[model samples]
Target: MNAHTKGKARSTRVKEGMTVKVVRGQHKGKQAKVSEVNTKKSTVYLEGIEATRRDGQKAPIPIHTSNLFVEAQK
Candidate 1:
């Protein structure tokens, strides 16, 4: 990140379709394509990587950028 005069943080450049793998949590080693990226929330949704909701439906869990390692570019 470049120095900012106003001290505003830089937004992540991650985009959809990039392949990434979880590296620091229980989901570690799991790899998938990035389905969505919420830069405002600093989270990412991975394709086929989801958690079961209370209603029995699969929901995409928000994985923080710090936990992911990009394997392929978009």
Candidate 2:
């Protein structure tokens, strides 16, 4: 497995479609659902919150797990 895949396998506890809140970044304090978990890319897609190329303009992207804190309530 690649480094990205290995890392994700180790770090991620929650699966896709879970709710997560951005703890850091321009979108900080924003809540979004976990869209996709890319172990090979070590990236998680938070639907409707991540930076996108719009009107040919770029904005600061959402934070990664390093900058994110998952709030899981039992």
Best by TM-score: 1
> lDDT of all the models against the reference?
0.86, 0.64
Instruction: Give per-model TM-scores.
Output: 0.79, 0.58
Candidate 1 worst ten-residue window by lDDT: 3-12
Which pairs clash inside model 1?
A: none
Model 2, position 50, has a per-residue lDDT of 42
| lDDT of model 2 at position 43 | 62
Tens digits of per-residue lDDT for model 1, 1-74: 55586686444477899989899887899999999889899999998888998999999989999998878787
Kindly list the per-residue Cα lDDT of model 2 for residues 1-74, writing each as its tens digit. 68786655334465577777777767778777777776665566777864557687644443456666676522
What TM-score should be assigned to candidate 2?
Answer: 0.58
For every model shown, the clashing-pair count is 0, 0
Q: Where does candidate 1 stray beyond 4 Å?
A: 1-12
Cα displacement (angstroms), candidate 1, residue 64, comes to 0.2
Report the Cα RMSD per candidate: 5.5, 8.1
